[model samples]
Target: MSQTPIRRLAAREPEFLSTLDALLAFEAEADGRIDAAVTEILQAVRTTGDAAVVEYTRRFDGLDVQSMVALELPRSELLLALDSLRPEQREALTIAADRVRVYHERQKGESWEFTEADGTRLGQKVTPLDRVGLYVPGGRASYPSSVLMNAIPAKVAGVGELIMVVPTPRGEKNPLVLAAAAITGVDRVFTIGGAQAVAALAYGTQTIPQVDKIVGPGNAYVAEAKRRVFGTVGIDMVAGPSEVLIISDGSGHADWVAMDLFAQAEHDELAQSILLCTDAGFIDAVHDAIDRLLPTMPRRDTIARSLANRGALIHVDSLEQACALANRIAPEHLELALEDAEDWIAHIRHAGAIFVGHWAVEALGDYCAGPNHVLPTMRSARFSSPLGTYDFQKRTSIVHISQAGAQHLGKVASILAHGEGLQAHARSAEMRLKV
Candidate 1:
């Protein structure tokens, strides 16, 4: 097999930043047709309710059903799916669920307050969303892992209800996905997806209950739909393609590093995978490893296209330089595949998740490694974070003013309110003051 030559850049090159920027750039352009279609679907679901959902399901998924009840999978069906799984499958799923639940439990926020000497109590009350919608991809793209990553956090956060929507193309349902819903305590499972499902979740249908927030990955149509309904309902994020950036020293095995890059590249043709090494000789060895191992992968075509388009093998002067470039990339998944991986962690200012040392593969974190896999991509990690218990929860500020406290605080508030040209606010504060 003739291998595609991955792009190589040097840290010393004058155009290095420009070259990297071009590769990292992935802007989500709204397709006019998709947007129009989504708008129609959203409006239809809002106005017509279940009838529109049934029609879209028939039109898109080839599922001819008379009633929306046909689309709703019962809790017994979820239990049946769980029972049907092989012992090994059930065990693995259970273990992963346990780990994810345990990890997210620690992130559950508690209501806290501190009373002042003047009897003024100020604090925050942490509360979970009443209901949340989870979109899990179905058909040929079945991801049980995604179910665990999204649902477990919500359950841990004490969300009142966790409703899931998965498209069952041709009326075929993946058992593993159903089992995951059962394991994660999803309140309802609807075999509807795309823009319609999002709409149903946003605007309550007779059958599908409205959700406080929607979280999970979906196709371009689903993503655009989520974007349009942002203020109407909260969405996790309209994520871009997956990314993995590895900063490796020459000490690690070349084969391991090459496989790590391949694991990420195999996700999709646009998924970016880059490696930064201080040793040029090690980069050559990784190149050879990629060529030798490329034939063995099932998704070699995808890996090849991704590498040819976005992948890079960079030569850096030192590990410090590699860390600097990593922060600039702000990749979704970062691997410090080096001897002293811990030493450089403090230097990294951005990344969705950091996989330390050679043995700590990013794939583990995606599944049973006890962290959420729904991470920010396309440099959004510079400011955002991986989906967690916090996403499913919210906080409300609490304020109780005592006579003594308000008298002292009202004067300060009046000054600020008056400076902002709000006479009403200033007068309101002044009325509470003794003076």
Candidate 2:
């Protein structure tokens, strides 16, 4: 038989923790050229507006367009694209968009207020972002799901306008993405991408309006542009590679577990898939399944490379040990493939999304499971959360001081201000105490 496609680790080994940490390390040093180019592009877009955006579109995307008007897709074009989809594709897009909209509708928060005994009133005003820009990687890479995921939530949150910018390299547009925009209520569509697209959205051009936030994924250049323009506009998290960690308890079929691992591995060479099981015999069965099935996969080469580089089939002492290690990894997708999967969910503290039971696969969550597939990666699940309606909304604290309320709160503010050596603040609060 050929060599196994994955690495192996034991919970009892002396160097297990260190070895695992080594495998988890994914920090690639920033490229100086890419950063420099992004800086220049941002500056150019900021200074020259529509002219720079048009020039970059022609140079990078190879689209021969004289004006920005040619780049913008009117509402009628979007409608025509939607009409052009096959019946099956249209039905599927409609269902996915509806499910996403229904899910995010539950996440919409309401403005709330409270009154104290002293007649003081205070509250919070929950307001949706005025406008948002979505960036989708175009040209042969069609991600209609991204349009559904990002745009549905923004629409559900009552965002005023949603602009979509997709790069159609050499004038090749993905009709599915445009159809998705049609279904998700995108107000505008621009055939522009990369750092320049981000720059145009962050700082408005003549035709492209500035947005309150930017969402969706793109290549390295686009990621860097979003990173630099963060202070000027809000952005979804800069995500890393997709990931999945499956913990088995010898109950599920070995082939099922193997395919789940392969599902994540197939995303890209950098995507990670690891299986943690307690039974030694079950581990052997999974290994045999991997050997038998690896050859049949269309993306066999990518799967093999990813498994060799980062994937693992670990043997742990107990289910408890698996849970602890999973918490340490903080994976983007965590699958509990066991008989009592629900029982162990409480033990998991950190994960971008949890797939409970054997049937609730991660792939379902990617498409129709109704949760946002845009999750934090690179162990960032420990600190961040999935994108949702809350991401497109902002909260402002409301404070209205009454005469009796000021009399009570002013002294406390005065005391704190004086202690901090800010006499102006102290006097400002002190002046209200006369009431």
Candidate 1 positional error at 349, Å: 1.0
Q: For model 2, how does the per-residue alpha-carbon lDDT over 1-435 read when each residue is reduced to its tens digit?
A: 437668988889999999998888897569999999999999999999999999999999999998899999998888899999999999998998889989999999999999999989999999999999999999977799999999999999999999999999999988899999999989999999999999999999889899999999998899999999998999998888889999999999999999999999988898899999998889889989988999999998898888999999899999999999999999999999989999999999989999999899999899888999999899998999999999999999999889999998999999999999999999999999975
Give the clashing residue pairs of candidate 1, or none: none
TM-score of 2: 0.98
The pairs that clash in candidate 2 are none
Question: Residue-wise lDDT of candidate 1 within 117-226, one digit each (tens)?
Answer: 99999999999999999999999999999999999999989999999999999988999999999999999999999999999999989988889899999999999899
Worst 10-residue lDDT window, candidate 2: 1-10
Clashes of each: 0, 0
The alpha-carbon RMSD values of the candidates against the true structure, listed in the order shown, are 1.2, 1.2
Error of 1 at 381 (Å): 1.2
The residue ranges of model 2 lying beyond 4 angstroms of the native Cα positions read: none
